[model samples]
Target chain A: MVRYKAVIAYDGTHFNGFQKQPNGRTVQQEVEKTLQKMNNGEPVTIFGSGRTDAGVHALGQVIHFDYPQERPLERMRFALDTQTPEDIAVSSVEIAADDFHARYHVVEKTYHFKVQIEKPRSPFRRFYASYFPYPLDLNLIRQALPDLLGTHDFTSFCATGGAIEDKVRTIYQADLVVNEAGTELTFIFRGNGFLYKMIRILVGTLLKIGNGRIPADSIPEILAAKDRNLAGPTAHPEGLYLAEVKYK
Target chain B: MVRYKAVIAYDGTHFNGFQKQPNGRTVQQEVEKTLQKMNNGEPVTIFGSGRTDAGVHALGQVIHFDYPQERPLERMRFALDTQTPEDIAVSSVEIAADDFHARYHVVEKTYHFKVQIEKPRSPFRRFYASYFPYPLDLNLIRQALPDLLGTHDFTSFCATGGAIEDKVRTIYQADLVVNEAGTELTFIFRGNGFLYKMIRILVGTLLKIGNGRIPADSIPEILAAKDRNLAGPTAHPEGLYLAEVKYK
Candidate 1:
């Protein structure tokens, strides 16, 4: 069997997310189906780095698959293109070790959340960004980032169905950057792993800080609470994207 | 009456171009409806620099409108946030002289046509850009630009439309720029006025030049032929955008 690793990019608007589903269309199923057709009607299984919720997007998603062929890599790329839609693309492909499972080999991941504060809508940036009419306090959100760093319990920042065995995760970085244009705000996070709805909840709490509903230093207290109810509402999934993944 | 000149921007994916239509939802109709609502049911006509075809986008489309009430321009900019959809926006508003006309007093107009040349789908950019799977010869397309400059009969380039009294138009600048990343190709055209489908025809013939199907010098001969049948196919409308309209 020939093992291949591919870097993918997708607009998640039409997808139910990355994972395979029974009824709804998914990025994984579409790729696997395309592979099956290329292999003359043989179903194939492909492994992805992680699961992105519905409506989320990805710029550098990594994946791995095994196929019983000794063909050149270029032909495989062209074959996949012939089978997939215009919204999903295989940005890169290469030969990989047999043990290179996309999920197990991941070392680092990054996520970005965007908020457009201006009243006028941006014509070119509508799909990839989220619009918020209310004004936000940037200073307060920036102050909370330092406390959220380091290994700590993030239970308060998780939504429902967060059944991870460990709630403690190390956040290498969490920073709030006011866009140079001054009309947008971006929250960037780098971590070992993320819990269910953790990033969205973190964004919601920061928004509250911007709204003056929650104190900037209250993040530590919320983490100590270990109660999801104490955190603010979850932000929308559209503005979130899997920017990159790193492996050792 | 307060004369306001606004620089508008819109993602034309959901809009039927820049003009008002009796049947379909148009960018002009939507903006007009919003303005009427804000003016307490007052009817106002907006004059755009030019009419963009259906499915075409715009970044710096200049327009002018009249209102009897004297209010801060910022209020009108903010009011559109609640009145219009996320795809359209009034980027800026300013006071202009009574004699200033968006269409009649134009100095220069810049239009850009964007084409995506990658194999995989770019989901986020699917609606805003045109996708072409085949590779293009950029140098050959560039070689054909010199013949397109200066005044010439443009009957072969334009579509059959309302009485075209003047068939000669001067093209101050015409060039095809390949993005630094080598991922996108944009064709920019600057002139006083354009006939129906002129840009699309120019693109079609240039594409033929790139494919070696026609020589670069064929453009002047095609102009001399004064027959539309000698030209290549007209390009799709989705790839075109009215980038800017300048007036001094």
Candidate 2:
């Protein structure tokens, strides 16, 4: 059997989530079903780098699966692309090392959170961005972003339900970019790892800080406190995106 | 009674069209339904600038309706904005002259058609753009656009469903803009009026000329011939947007 690694992109609006479940439609289930059809009705299991919650989109989500027979990479990609739903696309496919694991690879990930600050929210962007009607000070959020740039225990930023005990992770970058129209704000984060809903929590806290609800300089104390209740509410999932997954 | 003119926008992915019919959900139905509720359950009807086909989006579609009461414009806008589905938004509302008509007083209109030329189309754009995998020469399309300018009979570009006999229309502007990445093209057309599916047919003919299936200089002949069979097939509606409507 040959192991194949593929990069995929999906619009997650209608999907339940990335993980497979019996209740609702999911990206994994759709992809696996397509793969199984390609494998002549034999069950095919695929592993993703991580699970993205419902309504959260992905630009370069990575996955790996083993196939019983060898085929040209382009042919496989074409088959997968044509067979899967239009909302899910296989961007690239390549042979991977037999031991390569999509989930276990040691590397980094990048996420983007988009906020629409325009009043009377745009209909075209309603499903893709979170609307924030409150006034925001970008400088305040900029000043507070540095506190999250280094390795720290992110217990306060994690949502409950994750089974992982260690909440410490290294954040390589945290930055905000505004579009030319000044209507949308994109918060980009790159890290070695992220706790469940960590990015959403961080964005929520940062926006609160920008709006003066939370003090701009209180990130350090919040992290030191290591309590989930200390952080701001989780931001809406529609605006969150898994942008890139780098495996080394 | 007061005449209210409003500019609305919609995603149109789930909408049947801008016009109300017996079957399928439409933007007009949603807006009228919301307005009726606000008008004490009295049936309210909205007159749109024009009808857009299924899957065609809008950015600045204009509509006018008569209301029994005069409420604050902001309050009316807010009520309509909040009550309509998330896919539709009331951008602006104002009191208009008693004689002002949404469909009759239009001086100009602008429509935008988006085409994605990237291979293995991006999933995120599946609902908003038309994917063309063939090779296209933009210069060819640019050269042919001038033939479509000035006044001309556009019967060849008009779909057969409409009963309008006067197909002569003035083209103010016809331009093609490529995104910075060169992966997408936006075709903008400003004209006094358009017939049924005119923009889609024009885009289809333009793309055919760009791809060398038809001669780039044949636009004049097609317009003069006034034969629908001479033009290319109508393009997909998803890429078409009713961008703006103007009033004198």
Candidate 3:
């Protein structure tokens, strides 16, 4: 058997989430179903780098699976790409060491959250971005961003359902970029790891700061509090994206 | 009663079409439903610049409707914008003269057909673009575009289901624009008016020429024959967009 690693991208609008469950259609189930077809009726299980919540899109989610036979990388990629639903795409396929794991690897990740700041939101962007029509002060958000950099225990930002005990993670980058038309804001975050819903909460808190609902200098206090209630409400899942994953 | 003119945009993936029909949800039905709520439950009829087929999108579709009261234009625009589904947006509302008709006063219309040439189509663009993974020579398409400009009986390109008797239309522009990535081709056409499925058929024929399935120089012959069968197959509706409607 050969272990294959693949990069995937999905729209996430129609999917329940990246994980497989009996109740709803998911990215894992879809990919595994397609792989099973190619495996001559044998079941093929695939492991994703991590689970993305429902309605959260991904540009470069990683996965790994073992196949009974070896195939050309391009052919394998093409087969998976054409067979899966149009909302899911297999971008690349490569051979991986037997010991390699999609999950449990030492890595870094990058995420992006998009917000449409224009009034009366755009029809075309409704699914891909979160719409915010209120007045926002970018300078205030910028002032609070530095407080989020470096190592921090993100218990205040993490959702309650995750079983992770260690809340400390290193944030290498946190920045906001506005499009040329000034109608869209994109939040970028690169970190060694992220807790469940952590990025969404960070974005929500930053947006609150931008809109004057939260103080610009309150991030440090919020982090020190180690309480989920101290953070802002979680941003909508539609705007969050798993952009990249790096393994060492 | 006052006539209100509105510029509308919609993502047509979930819509039946732009016109009101007995079956399926349409953009007109949604807008009319909202207008009815605003008009004390009285039905308000709207006249559109033209009908767009099911699954075809629009960026600047024009419509005019008579209302019982005259409200601020921005307020009217906002009311309709927020009330409609997330896929539909009312961009602007204006007071129209009593004699100004949405369909009759139109001067020109711009339509765009987008084709994705890249292999393993991007999931994010599946709904917004038509994927064609084939070798296409853009120079051949460019060479044949001029034959489609100026005035001509476009019966060869019009689908047969329409009841319109006149098939002659003046084509003001026929251009193929390739984005910087060279992965997408946008076929833009501005004309006095278009018969049912005319723009889609034209794009289909142009893409055939680009791919060498049809001779690049046969456009004039197709126009002279005035036979729909002579034209290439009609392009997919998802790629077609009614981009703009102009009034004199």
Candidate 4:
């Protein structure tokens, strides 16, 4: 068997997400179906680096799978791309190392959460950004960003109902980029890994701190408390994007 | 009665068109509905600077109406914004001078047509831009642009079935902007006024010239022909936008 790797972009607005669920179509299921067709009716399974929730987009999502036969990588890419839906584009395909695993070998990953502040909702950004018409105190948000860096237990930021036992994760970088107009806020985060819904919850909590609902110094208490109730609400998935996944 | 002027924006994906007709909802119909509600069931008629075809967006569309009673301008703007659907927004509203007219005494109107070349479809821009998967020779397009300057009979560019006798129109600044990535093209046109689907037809003809389907120098002949049959196919309305309107 030969291992193949592929890079993908998808609009997640109408997708059930990257996982194969019983309810409806998903990014994973679509790719698998394409691969199965290419393999002449044989089944194919793909492993994604991680799963983004419904309505969360991905610009540089990475995945890998095994094929029983080998051919030119470009041909496979073209064949797969032609069959995928218009909302999904498989950008690049390549042969992978014999033991390469998409999820296990990742060294860094980045996610971007976009917030449109005080701007009228744009037809151009409806599915791409989350509109927050309320006032945002950027100064307050800046003051609370540093506490999220470095290795720490992120239980408070994870989904409240998930069964994952380990909650410790390392965040390498977390920063904000405000557009020149000051009407858009982008939360950029790079980390070793993230828990389920961790970035969204973290952004939500930080927004609360900026909005004065929570104190600037309260993040540590929330993290230390290790209680899901201590964190702010999860932000809308529409604004979240799986930007990049790095491996070497 | 107090006359009012307002700047409006809308995503035209699902709208029938900008003009009110006997059947279907239009930008005009929606605005009139909102105005009637505000006027306590009294109907209000508005004059638009011009009409945009179905699936054509607007960023600075202007309209004027009259109210039986006077109230704070800000209150009206807020009320219209809050009551309108998410796809439409009344950006600004104010009292107009007694003689102010939306369709007359206009100094400038700028329309922009966007074409995405060799870029993946974006869910956000699905309704806002047209996609063309072909190679374009920019040099040929630049060579033909000068013919569109100054006042000339634009009968060849207007829709064939329209009965407007005077086809002469003056085009001011017309240019092209390609983003740094070179994956998209924007055609900007500012003129005194536009005939029905004039911009779309011009873009279509220009694209044909650039792609070698038509000769660059043939533009003057096409203009002189003053016949609709001399022009190329009309471009898709999804790519056109009423970018701005100015009156002084």
Please report the candidate that would top DockQ against the real structure. 2
**Candidate 4 iRMS, in Å?**
2.5
Pairs in steric clash, model 2: none
Writing each residue's lDDT as its tens digit, candidate 2 over A50-108 gives 99999999988999999998899999999999899998989999999999999999499
The alpha-carbon deviation from the true structure for residue A143 of candidate 1, after best TM-score superposition, in angstroms, is 6.0
For candidate 1, give the lDDT of residue B74.
87
Global lDDT of each candidate:
0.84, 0.95, 0.93, 0.88
Predicted candidate 3 versus true structure: per-residue lDDT over B1-248, tens digit per residue: 99999999999999999889999999999999999998989999999999888899998999999998999999999999989888999999999999889999999999999999876798988888888888899999999999999999999999997788999999999999998888899999999999998988999999899999999999999999989999999899989999999998
lDDT at A239, model 1: 79
C-alpha lDDT of residue A136 in model 4: 73
Query: B1-248 in candidate 2: lDDT tens per residue?
Result: 99999999999889999999999999999999999999999998999999999999999999999999999999999999999999998999999999999999999999999999986898878889888999999999999999999999999999887789999999999999999888899999999999999999999999999999999999999999999999998999999999999999
Winning candidate number (TM-score): 2
Which window of 10 residues has the lowest lDDT sum in candidate 3 chain B?
B118-127
* Model 3, runs deviating above 4 Å: none
Candidate 1 structure quality by residue, lDDT tens digits, A97-196? 9889888888888999887776576767666767676768788888888998889988898876856778888899898777767877778999988888
Global CA lDDT computed for model 2: 0.95
Q: Which candidate leads in lDDT?
A: 2
lDDT of candidate 2 at residue B69, scale 0 to 100:
93
By TM-score rank, best first, the candidates go 2, 3, 4, 1
Full ranking by lDDT:
2, 3, 4, 1
- B-chain TM-score for every candidate: 0.94, 0.99, 0.98, 0.95
* DockQ, cand. 4: 0.41
